[model samples]
Target: MKNIISTIAFLFITINLISQENNQMKLGDKIGEFSALDDQGNVWKSTSAKSDFLVVYFYPAAMTGGCTKQACAYRDDKASFDELGVTVIGISGDEVKNLKYFKDSYQLNFPLLSDNEGTISKIFGVPANKGGEITREIDGENFLLVRSITTPRWTFILNKERKVIYKNAEVNAVEDSKNVKEIIKNYSK
Candidate 1:
């Protein structure tokens, strides 16, 4: 009985925390800034950030379909974002090696932040997989997926003031491109 009670309490607390993290809006939410190592072993953080605007996004894994599409979209459109003076930072639980592959494979122009211990992912409210096992599918084939359980997909548009001007909590990498474009167009300094 005591064990059951403790488990129930734990679940309740977990659910509440998930809810709070998942409900974050890109704008107006206080994002705790931290340093993440980039591909070249360079550390990127608020103190050393070099851009008029910043886009911080969290995803489930390194090379999944949705995650890939989203990342590639950003990769392919680096110039436009640069023209708008927006800097991009991507976060995931993948190790630096995997992040290197993802960047090299896609020729990602932006810095990929490593959160191997998932400490940073959790700080951003990115969810963890329910089971310890990470699984996914490619072309309808079963595969072992190693990433957090679920990531709260979001885009934060920080203006020159470092204040979030726009946020997209509901993420669709394909469809959200329009929003991304507009925010940069409007907020680009």
Candidate 2:
């Protein structure tokens, strides 16, 4: 009985380690193709991005201060991003409905993906915690937004070859788009 229990524990640990190893991503790593539901409830796939670079940013939640600022910054800089041939995507653990609300509220131009299960966050090695609910007043109506997990602000830039060229774990919400533009400018040169 003791040997069986110990063997089972060993197997569990090994499996967990293997899973983490497979999901872990870092600078220079080529991210595998992935797809998720966007704010419009349409499927967004990595392979569908037609750009010289791709920006994948993970934020904690929707209807929050920092996330809103970050998203708005991106939306405001859509022209610049397009000129630079860069596609921007924001990922969060929020539900699809919540993502739609966020995008609609802010008039976000970029894709906001629903990573409600934290699978994409795990692949990017972004830390996530248990999710909760937040009530926000929108147009005189109180809406409850729930998320499956909360991921810290993190950003990654992938080159045309899909290799991670830049990774920012400590991102400045408001300056994220500006900083990314600078990085892309320099990287292009």
In order, candidate lDDTs are 0.69, 0.93
**How good is model 2 by TM-score?**
0.89
Q: Which lDDT tens digits does candidate 2 get at residues 1-189?
A: 999999999999899768765766777999889899999899999999979999999999999999999999999999999999999999999999999999999999999999988778877878678998999988899999999999889999999999999999899999999999999999999
RMSD of each: 4.4, 3.0
* Span of ten consecutive residues with least summed lDDT in model 1: 130-139
In candidate 2, which residue ranges exceed 4 Å CA deviation? 1-23
Candidate 1 RMSD computed on C-alpha atoms after optimal superposition onto the true structure: 4.4
Best by lDDT: 2
Q: Which one wins on TM-score?
A: 2
